[model samples]
Target: MSLSRTLTRRQTLLAGLASGVMLARPRIASAAPTEFVMGVNGGAAYRNLYNNVLRHFEARHNAKVVPVFGSGSELLNRVLAERSRPTMDCFVTFQGAWLVGKAEGVLEKVDYNKIPHIDDVHDFLKDPDGYAPFVNFGAWGIVYNKDTVRTPPRSFKALWDRAYDRKVMLGGVYHWQIHLAAFAYAWTGDQKNIDVAFDKVKELAPRLAGLYGLSSDTQSKFQQGIADIAPWYSYTAQRVRQLGVPVAFQMPEEGGFLYPSAYHAVKGTQKVELVEKLIGTFYDPELQPGLAREDGFIPSNKKTVLPAAVAAELPTMEEVQRCHHWDWALINRDEGAWLNRWNAEVRRLVRG
Candidate 1:
């Protein structure tokens, strides 16, 4: 992961393909278009992404993409369940789920050479073990109702204050780990301390509104006034604002946390070429900028630049570097024990 080495290699590989896309070998016009399946979370934002950014990739590859949309865990289970003969060719998900997939034998150790984007991506975003390369990420932090809370919150400690009683909400399952990691780091100076998180969730339970199961649930609660403040990613915050709720997001005192998404070929699938093509589409300098403009995501491709106005609204590269790093592999290993403890102590106590 040396910067000097990456730069030297990038210069050599990018020299020959400077003018055009480094694409998969061209598909024959007479052959039936290959149908490639991609797993994604189903929702309006994802649907918009498919229509705007992904469709072009499909066209260029002469492939018909069939997206199988579900939550991160659901998609992981689907691939694991279908491991013998994978109906899905590519698996796309967040870090936590990817960790599980890697441990459970559902994912392959990706060939970095096959994924041309690996060189263009920020060094931190590429998996050193080569499971997958992160395509994009959004910083997760405090999202609060502007009307109720006149001032912006500065720390994770703010969520536990009696000031927001019966008003706090946090995102989907994987988000539970993000929330846990933040408080764990704040209290113990260790993000891997799930024990601290378990204690904090219980301590915050009297005030806890809900542990949301989906982004839609958070949007609905924010719209209906059931949640006054919570932890959410930039995109989910935007959706809450679209619901006509006056919500604002901030990088908290503890700093924003990183939750990234990546796509890799399923272990037993025969669509490696198409999967590599999809990853190349993510790294394409010309096309990668659209994801930032359309979805507020921070692209992994270093060459992808955001418009001045759009860049102003999103977290800067400096802020992205300072965001808290997640120990997803540890979380995935302890998830079973943590969930059991959470249900025993924290779940039944949540009011919403």
Candidate 2:
């Protein structure tokens, strides 16, 4: 061939080869999976612990977690409000509110096949309905500052003691229902029948320093010595103590209340499989112990072996066994009515 024609043909062949290589190259994979939204209880301790787990989960699955923190009731409200166009993928709530959420049909049934680690959860903590699975548990009891209170009160009745007048604090409406039930159980031997409990709370209202709505507020009250004694969760008490507060937790002789907090996949989440995997992480035996230690929560996974310090600070198994676990289903059935009564009658009686 002529030299010019040969050169043209060679250039054409090279251009065609380059075009073919470019066409064969794969497009960069679409962006990583969208972040999952989780609604969780609000508190510095809880936020820190959840963030740690989320970071680990994100790294492993190439997914991100966006945590939405609020009180259990507030989170439940958010889930219900957004039900038609669900924004949150998963929810973590205390038992009372979890039951309410379940009753409201805002949660999806847990698919055990997708979350195999759930098989390792303690049978007692499992949800019979398979909707919400318990992740951790904590006890509710009297929390007092050792330096301020010369003698620690030993029973729920102590709130009514004349000495504690205007020196006690109680959690707000929904949260304090557990305390009210405790008094009813102590006074009538029945948590479900709280008529007497209402009267008891009314009597003690005059003595209460105030009704605190946020955990942070409760903690601040105790830290500032504005409140001397109050009803509080043991896990939270431990967290406060770790902060160098002089707080101490005591289970009233009438018995303490134990509540199991759980995780539920919000119905209509597009990330069902990913949500299941995230829930499974909560039950990972290896991870549960560390989370339990950090948050002062009792791990739900039976295989979790907590470190010595964590175990020592947590309630003994026997103590937990003896603690009263409210029939949240029954409570949920009438929770709204109870809250109405509390707002109308009980809350109005708060001294200030």
Candidate 2 lDDT at 313 equals: 79
Q: Model 2: runs farther than 4 Å from truth? A: 1-34
> Each model's TM-score?
0.85, 0.85
Q: Each candidate's lDDT (Cα)?
A: 0.77, 0.79
For residues 25-77, write the lDDT of model 2, one tens digit per residue.
63333346568888877667665566546666777677877888877778889
For model 2, the run of ten residues with the poorest summed lDDT: 25-34
lDDT tens digits, residue span 1-352, model 1: 8777667776867865653342433333235678898887777767656865579778888898888988777888999899887888887788888877887788876677987666888887788787778877888888888898887667777888787888888654546766777789877889877788778878888677877767777777887888778888875675456546788777777778887888878898887877777877877877766676666677778877778976775778888888887787677677678777766777777777
Deviation from truth (RMSD, Å), model 1? 12.4
Candidate 2 has an lDDT of: 0.79
